[model samples]
Target: KATMGVIERNGTYEQLGSITTPTLIVVGDEDAATPYSKSERMHFAIKSSKFAVIKRAGHTATVEEPEQVNTVISKFLECCV
Candidate 1:
């Protein structure tokens, strides 16, 4: 659950706020590992970004609610394009 290594190696967090790409930040309401607030911060930092919260799920929302996750991802992709 620790992304610090990846972030440091890739320098992902260094320029996070500068990224202008269409970003979809998805988080689970019950995600204790990463937490929803961390996802919210990313969404806020990115200029062109969308955020989604899946209920009744933990860190793995895509697995917990496939249909809901797909719908949200589809809608976000559509909107971005």
Candidate 2:
């Protein structure tokens, strides 16, 4: 099921703008699972989106830099409210 979803993910870039809510997109500077470039593209597509890059981290950025990820998330939530 997960593989199928990955192979055929729903939604399109044209629909991204429909998301009016403020969005926080965090990705590692060296994320291999999903490259940071993809996240940057998403930030560009979403008008209300903010992007953050976790330096010296990879796909598991949250695990590799829990404190940094938490801090970023906290700041995003604070600004969102």
Candidate 3:
């Protein structure tokens, strides 16, 4: 219910612009629950952020393409450190 409220109220959207920390916005090319456009919006909102789209994957990109997801996250972390 709380998660639904956050989504319905656009709470996270409202707060995205204020984020200053480095962020990695990842989405699957075929994501439906949280579409690619949403991830793009988040990438734009967060000043310091990177966007990655996993090809041939869906909403469960982490589980569907674990290796690709891990590689992207690893690369992002490397840049951060």
Q: Clashing pairs in model 3?
A: none
Tell me each candidate's TM-score. 0.82, 0.86, 0.86
Candidate 1 local lDDT, 22-47, one digit each (tens): 99998989999779888888888898
How big is the positional error of residue 41 in model 3, measured in Å on the Cα after superposition?
A: 0.6
Ten consecutive residues with minimal summed lDDT in candidate 1? 5-14
Superposed Cα deviation of residue 43, candidate 1 (Å): 0.5
As for TM-score, the candidate ahead, 1 or 2, is 2
Better of 1 and 2 by lDDT: 2
- Comparing 1 with 3 on TM-score, the higher-scoring candidate is 3
| Selected candidate, larger lDDT, 1 vs 3 | 3
The sequence of per-residue lDDT tens digits that candidate 2 reaches over residues 43-78 is: 999997999999888989999998889999999999
Error of 1 at 35 (Å): 0.7
Off by over 4 Å in 2: none
At residue 30, candidate 1 shows an lDDT of: 95
